[model samples]
Target: MNHRCPAVLVHGWRSHPGIWNRLAPVLSDTAVPFWRFDHTAMQGAGTETIALALRDYIRAKREETGYTGPVDIVCHSMGTCIARYLLEVLDGDAREEQVRQLVGIGPPNNGSAMAELFNDPERGPEVIRRLVGVFVPEDYDPGDDTIVQEFRPRSRTIAALRRAGTRDDIAYRILLGANLTATPAFFPVFSGKTWEFAPDGGWRTTYAGDGIVPHSDSLLPGAQVDVFPTDPANLARNPELYCHTILPKNPELVARVRDYLTLSARPAARTPPRS
Candidate 1:
């Protein structure tokens, strides 16, 4: 814990911080004040509620880490959307500059299977509720998925960041997998409705997907696409590593993310952020 304005890692949907277990130590080894936080706020808490809660959490983290100014946010999967909300929507560009960098891994920046689920009448109800139980209740609506609403190229989030934007001042990096497939975890999309789940056949998302996110949606149309593997995934066997949520397990992916967060970043000493 030596980096003053150390990096804070955020994990994605239906997942815990354990996903970064192997990776955090690597960040720690960087001599940065690295930590992972619980994502209780992102679940089904809706947009504004989750945003304010996360805004408070980030403020607390920055203060606790003794960060004098901006802090890097390294996010995974759906966590990227949360990070975007924190910087772009919650605090706006004025405060976003305090963010040194945003490293998004396996981010469905365009949207997610959850977006597909949230939009699907059959699956959206069960997945959108903040509470997870065996049986899904009758009525639920997550309003509008910020990912679908706020993350697009011309999106309020992106547009706002772009307006208050700075290339050198605030960095953005996106990393996504290509060995994509359909997520079977979602309830089948066919409940006899005009809205079909696998519009592209049994796939729960777009044609070129990472099992959880469409490859195309992984990055905003014009945003930096960063890097992709040399090979496309085998749709049949569908390697487990290609799954939307499996990024932390791969040494290569971890290294890529590690490098992304650490590149050109000078090291600083550890201290609780100033409140």
Candidate 2:
């Protein structure tokens, strides 16, 4: 163990750390400090409530570690939103100073099409689907403030991070995956979107979608995007990574993530070329 600044991993909405069990092994191989949090309760909650819970955990973790240093945060999907909120919205000079980097995969920085649909005015009260909002707890009122962002410029959390102006302190990188690859089954995410299957089994990743999220919404701002090849088996079986196509394990992609993190953290070496 390096015993220095540790790294934390936060999973996205309607998910658990277990979802990344395979990915976690990859991080462990690199000896990076990996942490996971269960935020099933954050679904309907407002920012403040979520922030308070995260702040409490941060303080607790700091005390537990008994170390004074920065910590790296790695997140995926909606979890990216929570981690960003913690780093930026929660008050603390020490935190801003200590954070080494923020790396997110499929973070939906702009917001998910599903979220937009839920927040859509045309949907009205029917927008809040009973089955879909299970992860969101009952306490937090969805009718509160309407910033509608995780960590973008307009988001309260992102605004705070920018105001803190510790750009030199904490760095950010985003890894993007097409929703088609993230989806569990090769199906359209939005209603009324579907593919016309031919008499034969062969089919393409049509305009329909992976299942839950759209491709356009997956690309968030302020982050670099890395496209991963869809799981070959997925193409063969017509099953995507997830409804969002963000979860299917792609080993090649795992290697890429390892490379990106290691390179990002590594000190560049100078070479003396010979004639």
Most TM-score-accurate candidate:
1
Give lDDT for model 2. 0.51
TM-scores, each model vs. reference:
0.65, 0.63
Candidate 1 lDDT, 152-204, residue by residue in tens: 34445555544543344566776655432333322122211112135454434
Each candidate: what lDDT? 0.56, 0.51
Q: Report the lDDT tens digits of candidate 2 across residue range 1-275.
A: 47535667677665666766777788787886665666666665655566567656666777887756777767766666666666665644445436777776655554454454444455523535442443244443344523344432345555554465434456676553333333333433333132222237322233333334334444444444554343434444434443343442445455655665565433221111110
| Model 1 alpha-carbon drift over 4 Å, by segment | 1-5, 121-168, 180-207, 227-238, 264-275
The total of clashing pairs for model 1 equals: 12
Error of 2 at 53 (Å): 2.4
Q: After superposition, how far is residue 118 of candidate 1 from its true place, in Å?
A: 5.2
Candidate 1 lDDT (Cα, whole model)?
A: 0.56
Question: How well does candidate 2 match the true structure in TM-score terms?
Answer: 0.63
Error of 1 at 210 (Å): 1.0
